[model samples]
Target chain A: MSRIEGRFKQLAMQGRTVLIPYIVAGDPAQDVTVPLMHQLVESGADMIELGVAFSDPMAEGPVIQLAHERALASHTSLSSVLTMVQVFRETDATTPVLLMGYANPVMHMGYAAFADAAGAAGVDGLITVDIPPEEVDGINSELQRVGIDNIFLVAPTTPEERIAQIAARASGFIYYVSLKGVTGAGNLDTKEVASRLKLIRKHSDLPVAVGFGIKDAASAAAVATVADGVVVGSALVDTLAQAFAGGGDQAVALGSAGKLLKQIHQGIANAAS
Target chain B: MTRNTEENIFATVPDEQGRYGVYGGKYVSETLMAALAELESVYRMLSVDPDFQRQLDEDLTHYVGRPSPLYEASRWSDNIGGARIFLKREDLNHTGAHKINNTIGQALLAKHMGKKRVIAETGAGQHGVATATIAARLGLECLVFMGEEDIRRQALNVYRMKLLGAEVIPVTSGSRTLTDAMNEAMRDWVTNVDDTFYCIGTVAGPHPYPLLVRDFQCVIGREARAQSLNQVGRLPDALVACVGGGSNAIGLFHPFLEDSEVAMYGVEAGGHGISTDQHAAPLTAGSPGVLHGNRTYLMQDSDGQIMETHSVSAGLDYPGVGPEHSWLKDLGRVNYVVADDDEALRAFHTLTRVEGIMPALETSHALAYAETLAAQMTPQQMIIVNLSGRGDKDIHTVAEIDGIEF
Candidate 1:
């Protein structure tokens, strides 16, 4: 089993809900990303999903869009993102880090080079939002050769038969989108998401991480009740935006990350109890 | 065997990697990560939904005028060395262009999603006009973003969009053209994510869009298939269309992709020449990069910044093409070549004088190529060209070029 899968299994046995914190890599500045990632883990994050920036992100919400713009303005390439992952690995090697982004950067770099670089950078897995099962073969073989998990998504709209296909290929975990539309645009229908999760569980033995529109502690708590983990992105990016807009000193940003992580943890813990 | 031939071409596409060839892939912002995922799911569901297909078919037949005809241009054919040429008359659609085929399909999708507003970006104003027409018909508030330069050049189209009750927003950003207008439209979609739908003009953008738009525009090919077979007693020797964002080209070529006996050509704009930076031939000079919503072939500078493109025909002035076309070219299924401004202008006048048809400057590129190809072939050879739009909008521009007071 992969490190992320093992961690999830351990957490499951301990009756603990996994908290996955997501942040846009190279946002604000490339130099500060590793520190912020460390801060996230130190606060309470069990796994880290680092978003690689792209120029035209059609499916993004405003919060993440601004973050991408900031990264692109700094000219953050996929190479730089992997370099950051390598830097993070220098200090903390065991903490699972997944590169979460679109497929262009991977395609642009060539699949073999990307898989090698990602493996060397200590990236445990990849969750490309746009690489469907039909297109996975282009990069899947390289990823498998490098021992990197090819994570897949199963949405509420995914039929049962399709879910089985996705689950068969999916490693690491299945990212279950909790709602329709872009992230940060809609409210989560907990009952609907939970029922969908139940259906996914029947077909796939993989851990399910629910994301999209998991804004506050309450939403996180609601998701934790049914999902193996809760992936929070826009809200965290929103917090970073507010902190930076309000004079982002290092102390202020770290403090913001700590406070948000603690609240989300409390919510998940409360829901589990 | 009949059904198998039809299925073979489409099966080659959306390959094991969801790519049409090497052309289609997700090249997007990290912010939209989850949203793209959700869209993929919804698209997969809707693609096979009987209700969705029925609704789209109904709109295409009753609303957009299904099965636009294949007119055998006998006069033009006789003038061009007696080589027979037929025109798929998408220009006769309700909006005077083929762009409505896609806008109407996307508008219905927006309605199904409960979106109250629709936003679009335009270059030659055909897409903007199509979007505005659909938005008005669907009873949704519409906004169209166009480059300030395009707004000035295509003034009548801008007026038409306004008359259709769409708010035309002038974009004064980089190059002040289609690419910049698309950027502005994306910004609008990002801000108004709650109840807005972004109606992309062509078979471009993220994953599902390339697939979705192609499916909608396939009616052009499907209709032409029956018409051509009935009229010519067999399939044409060649399929030709001009590629801007590649909607019309795909519309015509898609149904014939698997016909090994038939050849396909997509003419790109070689503004000054292919060697110069002034051309809009992405397949000829561009590298694979992410622009708009998906990763496709794009004309970009060394720094990976998209370059400004130029074409005498505003519709053919884009720096990138639909992802599927990129893939198609890579797979060698279609030959993508360029026709310079001089050649296009020559054909534009030739069509007007010989055939009494004032072809759109965009379609003139294909005609120019056809003229050249016709000279090299015998009279027995046949070519079917997609006459995508009328030249009415270009009269002012053409007249000005001729030093005539319009």
Candidate 2:
């Protein structure tokens, strides 16, 4: 099993819910990002999902889009993001890092080079927003060869046959989109997510992480009850945005990250109890 | 260059990297690298699936009003005093433009991917209207990103999209037009990459979209090929069409690319003149640069920043041509030229008066170039132009220019 799967399994054995914190890498600035990522893990994050910034991020809402703009202004390329991952791994290597983003940049870099670089940077898995199961054959083989997990997404709209296809191709874990709209646009429907997870469970033995509108501790608690982990992004990005807007203080930004992750982790612990 | 193949025109010229010539390659930020790779895999699987092809054909035929009429413009031909001219009337398709052909195919792909939300960017609003229409039909929540300037200019299309149950979001960034709207739409796709599908309006963007849109719009060329052969007893001597991102031009030219005997011309919008900065003729004046998602001929300065383009026609105001068209120009398969604002205006009025067909300002550029080209050709020569869209949406702009509003 991969490191992420091993970590999740260990958490499951301890009756603890996995808290996955997501952030757009280079958002605000690269200097601040590595420290912030470390802060999230130090506080309570079990896994880290580092978002790769794309110029045209079709599925993002305004907040994350602004975050991407900030990162782009800093000229954050995929290589730069991998460097950040490498820097993080220097201090802490056990926590699994999943690079999440769209598919265009990877295609531009060529798949083999990307897989090698990502694996070298200590990236455990990948979650591309647009790639479906039908197209995973070549890339999946390449990633598997590099010992990197090629994660798949299963939405509420996914048909049973497609779910089975995705389950078969997916590795590390499956990401369950909580709603139909862009991130931060709509409220998450816990009952609907629970039912979707139940359906996904029948197809894949992989752990499923629910995301897209898991805003606060309550929503995280709700998702933890049904999902293997809860992925929080926009809310954490919003916290960082607020902190940055006030002033460029590392302590303030790190404090906010710690507070947000602690709240969600506490909620997850309480729910499990 | 294989002469005969069971596969369609798209299967003929695959790029060295497995792309569709130079048209379909992923050019995006590093963040989107993984996602695009995954999407490319899914697209390949679905492209050859018999079930997918069958379903797509059914939707195109029954839903999108396929096999659009091939009407010979008798009056216009007589006025030109030369060879007969035929129009493959894609404007008569559902949503009043050729945009639906692409939207329907993309919406289906979105459904197959289990995406429940559809998003699109529009300049003239025809694409937005079409995307919204299909999204509603497919029971998917639709969101359209339009530049603030476009929303003000294409008010009717905005209302139409909203009436069709889509939320129109006005983008106020960059140049505050189609490109900005496109940027916003891409941003949205990146954030919600898992559950949302972006229905690009034209034959542009990164790999898959340019190829995919061209494939969907290929119905125009496929039908016209048979119709012209049946009506005129042979193929036309020349095929002419406008090139706003070159979707319509590609749709018409693709089927005829291998026909060495048939000449093809793509009319670019020379807003004022090619020498001036106020034009959308990317192939004529711009160099190859990567923007949005793919590297293609783009109107940019020496500094590489995308330059602002001006055109009377909102639809043709974009600063880039589709990547496939760029490749075709280099390969010498099709001739790319430009038509100025005055020439297009004259052609627009002439077609409305002589043929009683109010052509869109974008299409008028093609007609304008055809008129000039026809003057130089013999009476025996013939031309086939793709009437990509109707002029109804452009009536207001025409009236404003002529100082006579309805």
Candidate 3:
């Protein structure tokens, strides 16, 4: 089984919601990413969604967009991101890692080559924000060949028919955008998220992970009630940004990122118990 | 001119799924797929509905001052000493540019779709002014996203949009240009999809947008063709249009795609030159990639990240082109060329001096190309240039370049 699917299955058996922390690779510095991945795992992150920085991150809010700028400014490229993932695999073999970004950078690397490189780097899945199911066949087939999951996002605005369509093509966990806006956008209505997840469950058996509005412990706990996994991006990235602002303190950034991840982890676990 | 009986494959493009020969698919986030599909279905219904056609036609005729004159630039042609040149006077439209054509059609669509708020993105501000104009007339709320740099440069057009009662939001993100403006606009649409109608100004977005914008602007080609038959007695030997997001070019080229003898040229902005990395001539200098909701020729780095594009005119300073332009360039249906900043400026001045017309710097790229192409042909031949907009908004830039404080 792919690493993502296996991780989800294990978490399901344990009655624990998978906690995924998203960090843009090379955000503050190039050397900080691999260590951050290991740190995240130690702090209770079940999987890592490493963002590949693109020049134009259209779906991102200001927080994540600044993170991308910082990553790009550090001379980060897809190849370097893969190298970081490979290094992370050296110490941790069980934690799943998924690359999340836009399509242009992946297309620049060529689909087959990217799939092979990602698989070799021990990457578990990919979530290209702009590539809908209608346009993902080329990359999807390549990822499938490499045993890497091709995860797709199901938005709150997505209709039932499209949810079924996306679910059919998606492997690993399906990312449900918990709100109607960018990554950092607020106003997450639990009732609305629950209703959407119910419809999504009717269409697919894959684990549903909710992202894009689960900012704090309360929000994560609220989502954990109806979701198999929870993803927190902008809030974590914002923490790292604060560290960078506070005199480029890598230790502080790592500590704060871990602290935030642990709080969300406890939130989910506490709600479950 | 040589003619071939090859069957025209250009008539039916962007098939049911919006694939224009491996380009122009709906490469958006899943949140936007349903909205795009709904728009496609609504446009399909209205495109054929008799009442809707009548309403659009009436708007084009009376409201937008359609059938903009096809004026022959005899003096400019005489100065060039070659092919006769005719200008499709899109500059004479109500909003002083070809942008109003698409805005009017989309505003009408928004009204029909029962959308109360309309949004648009602009680089040079002409499109913003046009959208604001239409939204004001239709009594719909309007918001325009413009890059910070463009808002500073095109202050007059920004003021015009404000005078028309539209809110102009300044985008302060990456590159701070048209591309960023588009990114901001997309975020707004995704957030407010229920009541907001995104009236795209160019032919570069996802499926139905490129298709819809092209259909709305095809009045240029349709009129040019009829005028060619009546005034020139035959299709022109060549057609020329500047391609930014390629709306004006597609509008002027779509109707003549089947005409074997009609040569077409799409002039891209070569800010410095295509050899330098400082130009916006993607079709000439860049490669195919997916960006801004479609796969097209993009100015990008080796890693596929979009590169900052440069041009004298903000309207033409975008990294990506329309997917249809990409397909056409590959099929050898249209000759894609470049005009550098200096050449476009020269042509801008030449047109003003010789033809008593001041072309927008974006449109001057086409005129620059036409000047070169016209000089190579005999006087018996004719070339039609799409005067896509007027240069009134660019007077300050020109004055600054000339070291005059205006």
Return the candidate ranking by DockQ, descending: 3, 1, 2
lDDT score for residue B280 of model 3: 95
Query: How displaced is residue A10 in candidate 3, in Å?
Result: 1.5
For every candidate structure, what is the RMSD over all alpha carbons to the true structure, in angstroms? 6.1, 7.0, 1.1
lDDT of 2 by residue, B175-249 (tens): 678887988887777667777888898888876678778888888888898888788888888899999888888
Of candidate 1 chain B, the 10-residue stretch with the lowest lDDT total is: B27-36
Query: Which of the two candidates, 1 or 2, achieves a greater DockQ against the reference?
Result: 1
True contacts kept of each: 0.08, 0.10, 0.85
What is the alpha-carbon lDDT of model 1 when measured against the actual structure? 0.83
Off by over 4 Å in 3: B1-6
What is every candidate's C-alpha DockQ against the true complex, given to 2 decimals? 0.10, 0.09, 0.88
Model 3 B-chain TM: 0.98
Q: Score residue A130 of candidate 2 by CA lDDT.
A: 56
**Per-residue alpha-carbon lDDT of model 3 for A1-273, expressed as tens digits?**
788889899999999999999999999789999988888998999999999999988899999999999999999999999999999889889999999999999998999999999999999999999999888889999998989999999998898888989989999989999888888897799999999999999999999999999898999998999899999899999988998798857777899889999998999999999
User: Least lDDT summed over 10 consecutive residues: which range in candidate 3 chain B?
Assistant: B1-10
Off by over 4 Å in 1: A9-16, A242-259, A262-273, B1-89, B100-123, B131-162, B165-239, B253-264, B271-279, B287-333, B340-361, B367-385, B391-406
